[model samples]
Each structure stands twice: as structure tokens, then as C-alpha cells.
Target: MAGAQRLAQTLAGRLDTTFTKVGTPRTPLDADWQAQLASALPELRQLAETLTLRLVEGHKPLAVLPRCAAALATLPVIARHHPDACLIWLDAHGDLNTPASSVSGYLGGMVLTAAAELWDSGLGSGWRLDQVVLADGRELDQAELALITQYDIRHLTSESLTPEALSQAIGNRPVYLHLDCDLLAPGLMPTEYSVAGGPDLAQLYALCSAIGHHELIGLEVAEFEEQPDFAMAEAAEALCDALAPVYERLYR
Candidate 1:
């Protein structure tokens, strides 16, 4: 959370616009978690419409992402202005495993499926699996691989996250960028979920530049720990530097 807050501050200093903090729900996720998020939707939506750039910082529990996605969908800008806004999910894991197919039963692993809710009972949100573009996920589980094949969701491999390919994936829709810190290469980012063989720092900056120049409605950087190691600190600094251009592009 401190990392995110610091990033927000950094952006505030560099960019022409101020970074407004859109508060996340404090309630612990339980059976009524969806309802809790829904009740908070109006306020979130208002902020989305009002603020130039809203940076949402959180622990980013996968179980709560579906609810978060629900609230984001209701953002008056997305719901009213850009109805065709799609999600760009940058992560190391596929996050497509369902409870039945999951081997580890980790809630974070099922985030994309939960957000899309294409199979299970949905959070009554607008996102569908078809509207998501998954990038840089090399740590996919067997079940996730099977599900992606069955659903035909666009999975952009590490080799495929190039500028031309990303442009094609995004097409004409505005984007909601969801960046998991673990998307960085294992040694680059010291998050709990870091995986090897992901994009390096140069590729990461290029990736950010590619999609960020497009129509971006919102940005969320998640899974940052309250306490970071030396490697994590370095990684976070690099991320902020890369995104400085993205922040500039938002106004352009």
C-alpha cells in the first residue's frame, strides 16, 4: 500500500494532473462482499467521472477483484461515456482457474474468471472474458491452459506483448489497465507471486508505452506489499519512471 501511495505521489509531482485517491472498501470480503462493494459503487463511479487520473492502490486480493471490477464497470465514464471499454490484464499468472479446476485453490489464481464471471454466477457486472486481453502470463496452471483453450480468450504470450500486437488486441475500445506487480520478471519485482521468464524492464516500459497512449479510462497497480525488499524497491522505482510517459499521454 505504501508503494502505491508513493507512486501516486510521484505521478502527482511529474504529471500536470493530481492523482486522486479512490478509497477501496474496508470491509473484509465475505458472503456479502459483493453487496458491500455495490453499496460503495456510486461513490467510486463519481470519482471516476470527476478525477482526471485515479490511482487505486490495494493489497489486491483476487477474491475481491470481481467486486472491484463490478464497481469499475459502473464508473459513469465507462458506463455512460465509453461503453465499449475493455480490460487489459497484465499478470504473471493466468488467473483463469475456477474452483473446480484449481489445483492450489488459491483465490488470487481465479481473479480473471471471477471478474469476467462468464461461467459462474456473476457479480452482475459488465465485463466478459471476451472483453479481456491477458498479457505476459507464463505461469499458467494446467486447468487455466485448458480453460483458455475452451473459451478462446486472447492470451498474449511474453513474445506477443509487442506494440503492434498490443494495438491489435486493444483495437478501438478505451482501456482499463490492471497491472499486477508480479508481472515483472522474478528478480525484477520482489512480490510474493513473482515468476521467472516474464518481460524484462525494457520490454515492460515498452509495453506500458504501447497501450497507455490509447484511450485509458483508469489504472490500478496491485499486489504491492506494505513492506518491500531492496529488489522490490528498485522495481517500483522503475515502474514509476516507465509510467511517467503514460501519465503525460493521458492528457494528450
Candidate 2:
């Protein structure tokens, strides 16, 4: 089982979410896979129609966000209502590497670029790179660093996520939140992609709590790998607790 499913199950048990499982796309990055993603998009669009805070689970951040872009393309309602939606990308790495810039060539590393490119084509009506607040991004690649400087994407460094800062970054815009569990400080748990010197759980949760003041549209949590002895459970619990405010706002 993928860690995402386990995390979703655990979160469903604890939160007010309704669970729906979907197949993960296995095709490579090509036209065929892009077509498949287009077909798969409506599932999320249907969920978005409900106008509730939806929890999306995926094995990798790449698996979710790119597909989400496709889904968003079909959701005119969301676009009409949230034309100014901003993304709060919580990850240790910038996830801004293009295919030409990535050293590791990990598809997950290229997800942000893929999503950005999709939006560039006006696919999802998604937020632009400048609209993203990259919280706890400490493992940025050199290429990502250069691009971030060029684009001036905001990197969130406050010990606690401040509503003013968040508001300043993207004022009065609905938020689409993404959390990569790897963003947690080292040794919190065994994440699939670990980086050093990130925020601990307490600080991370504080950020989530601060997000409650915004109009949150959706959330996706990825990059959590299951561990033995309930360690993964503990980690998921911490995430759920931190996101409690957003969850409550969405659920209500």
C-alpha cells in the first residue's frame, strides 16, 4: 500500500472527510500520459463541485498536483469563484526544477514546473509561481534557486505562519494548500524525501493554524512514506492536528 492511502485512511478516521480512492497514473511523461491525466481530471472536478475542503492523497507530490491541474481545467465553477486562488507550497525542496535543470531527474522534483507549465497554457486556471508561498523550502537545487530569484517566489521563513505575511503574499485570494511531509524537520519521521533544518512538527502545525484565517479551497498531502511501529501513524496524526483549523473550516 502506498503511504498516501495509509495516511488518508488514518486522517479519515480522525477528520471529517469522505474517502474516495483513485488509481495512480503509471504512464511516463509523454502525450499519452497527458491524455490519460486529462481523462482522470473530472473525478477531482466533481469533488470540487461540492465546494468543500477536499483532501487528496497521493504517493508523490507529482502524482497529485499535475493531475490536479488537469482537473481544475474542467472546473469552471472553481475558476469563476476563485480566479485569484494562491498556493501555499509546503515542502523542504523548492520543487521548481524544470526537466533541463534537475540534477536528480526525479519526476517529483519536476512537479511544480509541470504544474506551472500547465497553468502557463491556461489549463487549470491555477495560481502562477509568484502566487506560491514556498514554506520551509530549504533543499532547493541551484537551478531552482536561480529561477526563484528570477521569479521572486516568496519563501516562508517565519517560525509561525503569519496571516499578515500570507495575506501580503496573496491578498484576499482563496488558498490551495499543499504539504510535503518531507518538509518536517529532520528526524521527525522517515519521509520519502528528507532534508535538513526544516521546521519541526510544532512549528509546522503553527503554520497550518495560521492558515485558518484564509479562504482555503483545497489541500493535498504527499511525500509521506509508511514506517513500522506506528511511526508513520504518529507523523500523520501530527499533520492532522496541525491542519485541524483548516479541516474544521472546510468541514463546517
Candidate 3:
């Protein structure tokens, strides 16, 4: 979450606007994942209401969240506000596991599934599977693969990313882009959980540029961690540079 704060501060300074933090945990939770989620429901609901108000006020959203599990809050707001919107999910894992199928019992890995109503989150409604697009998922569990094949979910590899292919993936619906920082190749950025191979910063820049051409509703960034040696504010500037096109389009 340090990385997200640095990024938000940098962007807010550049844009001459202030960022609002909905709430922060006073201390670490000494409990299991489900209990942690239960404790966090109030704050998550606050975030959902904030986004809903922005969309209702006709402002496009660009959220920098500490973790992807927070999507269990944000995704529903986006999906409900724009029923025809398609989420272009760019992540390192499928995040498609149900409570029963998840081996690690990590809530972040099942957020999208929660967003899809595969489980009742008590936050809000779920997204339509047909309006979803998964991209750059290099590490998928066997269960996730089965879910993909069973649902016929659209999955795009990094090698095939291009303007045409991206547009094809998004179809004619308006776009909501979710990016997990781990989606980048390791060593290029600092993230809590990164695997071996994925797209580089240049590819990320290109992807943002191409998606800028679409009717974009929002951008959600998650899982960026802090590295003491790597300057946080400097990394934030680089990220903002790569995201320049989409930010320009959204705030234009």
C-alpha cells in the first residue's frame, strides 16, 4: 500500500488535485481471511459508495487500491453502474477460484469470483461473465483453467496483445481496466507477489495507449509493494508516464 500512496500523491500533485483516503486499518487483524474480510466490510462499503457517487456524478474513476481483494468492493460498483461495461482484467493469476476450490485460501485470488457472485460477499451484485476479459495471466491454477474452459472466458496472452486484439477482446462495450502490478515482468517493478514471466513496462505503455482508444469508465491498480532501494515516488512517476495515455483520455 506504500507504493499506491506514493503513486496517488505523485498523480495528485501533477494534476493539482487532492486524493481522499476512505479509511485505514488502525492495526493488523489477528484473525483468518474470512474474519479479516468481515472486519473490513464497513470500509469496503464506504469505497463502493464513493465510486458509485462519482459514476453517478458523471466522473470517470481511477482508483489506486492496496490489494486486489478490494475489487470485491469496486468491481460491483462498476458493473452495476454500467451494466454493459466489460472489465479488462490484467493480472498474473486468474483470481477465479471459489472458496471450495482455492487451496491457499487467499481472498485476493478469489476476488473476481466473488465479484461474479460465485460466492455471496454481502457487498453488492456480481458481474456478468460474458462481459469479462482476462489478459496476461501467466500463472493459472488447474482449477482456474477448468473455470476458464468451462465458462469459455476470453483469455489473452501477452504475445498476442495489439490494438486489434485488445479491441476484439473488449468488443463494443465500454471498458473498465483492472491492473495488478504483478502483471509486469519481475525485477521491472516491486510487487508483493510476482512470478517469472509477463509483459514489460514498454508493453504496459502500449497496452494503456491502445485501451485509451476505447470508451473507458475506470482504472484500478493493485498489489504494488514498497522497495527501500527503489525510490517510491520515482517509481510512481514512471508508472504515471506509462499510464499517461489512459489518464489523459480519462481526465480529458
Best by TM-score: 3
Clashing pairs in 1: none
Report the lDDT of model 3 for residue 225: 69
Residue 29, candidate 1: Cα error in Å is 9.8
Candidate 2 C-alpha lDDT tens digits along 37-147? 455456545444443333222111112222223333323333345566677877777778765776765545655665556323223444457777887677776888887
Q: Spell out the clash pairs found in candidate 3.
A: none
lDDT of each: 0.61, 0.61, 0.84
Q: Where in model 3 is the C-alpha error above 4 Å?
A: none
Highest-scoring model, lDDT: 3
Q: Against the hidden true structure, what lDDT does model 2 obtain?
A: 0.61
The clash number for model 3 is 0
Runs in model 2 lying further than 4 Å from the true structure: 24-81, 118-125, 158-164
Better of 2 and 3 by lDDT: 3
Q: Count steric clashes of candidate 1.
A: 0
Q: What TM-score does each of the candidates earn?
A: 0.72, 0.73, 0.95
The alpha-carbon deviation from the true structure for residue 9 of candidate 2, after best TM-score superposition, in angstroms, is 1.4
